[model samples]
Target: MGSGIPVWSDLTISDGLKYISGSYKIAMVYSGDSAPMLVLENKHSYSWDICISASEVSSGVAFYSYDDIAQAFSNYGVS
Candidate 1:
């Protein structure tokens, strides 16, 4: 993995409804297993990809926590 999670990667999140405010992202990934799935990966963390439940999220989409997304990225590029 790299120093930390890259800002380019996508984190999938679903609510079984429309896209949440900040609870998800839009991305593309390959499918596997006996079913279909999304691909959420951070360039920094190439060692492994985070497989999230997509019962609500649309495939190839990245999702973030609507509650903490803004706070989480408060200092993303403040430097």
Candidate 2:
């Protein structure tokens, strides 16, 4: 797969929040000793990919849309 982020046009933030809040299937990809990367797949045709630092893995942060992720980054002055 390409390293570029995936685009999800059909999913909304509310939908993502509900999926995370409810039971969902997740796939974990680990690289060396670093924290495992997490992914939540949409049964249809997309997935939400998250890469958390080792320290923040235990502190759950739910993201429901691209806007949500963008807002979070903006909060940290990542724009």
Candidate 3:
């Protein structure tokens, strides 16, 4: 697998925000006062011949809100 940043398509950011928001809300239903942590992953490489899954790297941030997700994306240059 190659090691580098993944470039997101134009709609990815907006769509990702919606996904995170929805996920958080769903988790809130069961979380009580605890926060739901989202793991941010980026796929850096993939090959059909590898006979395995794509390569991904975690952002190492425990995102708990839309602002945290947005800031992490910006910090990692995901756009």
Candidate 4:
């Protein structure tokens, strides 16, 4: 994984979501499973106004945390 972050490649999206929706901080999202859309955890309060967009071809793992999402947007000056 990039930046030396360990990615659980063995875990499927459903399995990853189970842990992510609970306490797990990160997961690897395969290119095939990712789409051009925002995925927010409804259980947590988030800034609905923030819009971060990326291409479908930018394949990589992503974090589900609000802080991570916000940082990603900030990186692109979208926040």
Candidate 5:
């Protein structure tokens, strides 16, 4: 992560959603699964590839939380 980049893990859900809506990619991954079921891109550029892991929280269906997704972007320098 770059020093100038905003820390995604610190953003609130409301703020995170607003930011990603402008330009970002979203993928829904099942809990414990290794693949994303749906990939959503909103004016986002695929300048680089990113992989996000499952939340690992036991649930009937697992999905990446907003903060988790944001952190992945931050970790990979998506911005």
Candidate 6:
């Protein structure tokens, strides 16, 4: 909760990596978009939160995997 990035907030980590909360770091495959809690790059920084621009953003991790993220978005009518 003292990570400065707060918690349960949707953020864009980078381009291919995303952050999740559950007393641990979970990744590999998700179920939907879910708007990553602490979006970031695992190769760059896991504990620290980094900021980036929309056009500058590269490949990071999404809270979901493939259909998972897609599903979550669809469910929320995110299109």
Candidate 1 per-residue C-alpha lDDT over 1-79 given as tens digits, one digit per residue, 9 for 90 to 100: 1123344564444542355355454333434432234333445556554443334334543333434333333434210
Q: Candidate 6, residues 1-79: lDDT per residue as tens digits?
A: 3223334454344543244223333332223433334233345445443322222112443332344444444554543
TM-score of each: 0.27, 0.25, 0.33, 0.24, 0.38, 0.25
**Of the candidates numbered 5 and 6, which has the greater lDDT value?**
5
Worst 10 residues of 5 by lDDT: 2-11
32: Cα error in model 5, Å: 9.3
Q: Put down candidate 3 lDDT per residue, 16-55, tens digits, no spaces.
A: 4455552452111112333323344543442111111112
Best by lDDT: 5
Clashing pairs in 5: 31-62
lDDT by residue for model 4 over 13-65, one digit each (tens)? 44333443333444435455553344443234444444334432335654455
Q: On lDDT, who's better, 1 or 2?
A: 1
Instruction: Encode model 5's per-residue lDDT on 8-74: one tens digit a residue.
Output: 3221233345655424334332444344332323335646555565454344334455566777777
Candidate 6 Cα errors over 4 Å, as ranges: 1-11, 14-63
**Two-way TM-score contest, 1 vs 3, winner:** 3
User: Candidate 4: where are CA atoms >4 Å away?
Assistant: 1-63
List runs of model 1 lying over 4 Å from the truth. 1-35, 57-79
Q: Taking the tens digit of each residue's C-alpha lDDT, what string does model 2 give over 12-78?
A: 3345544332233332233344444333343565443333332233234322334444454455554
User: What's the CA error at residue 1 for candidate 1, in Å?
Assistant: 32
Full-model lDDT for every candidate = 0.39, 0.37, 0.36, 0.43, 0.45, 0.36
The C-alpha stretches of model 2 lying farther than 4 A from their native spots are 1-16, 19-32, 47-79
Q: Which model scores highest in TM-score? A: 5
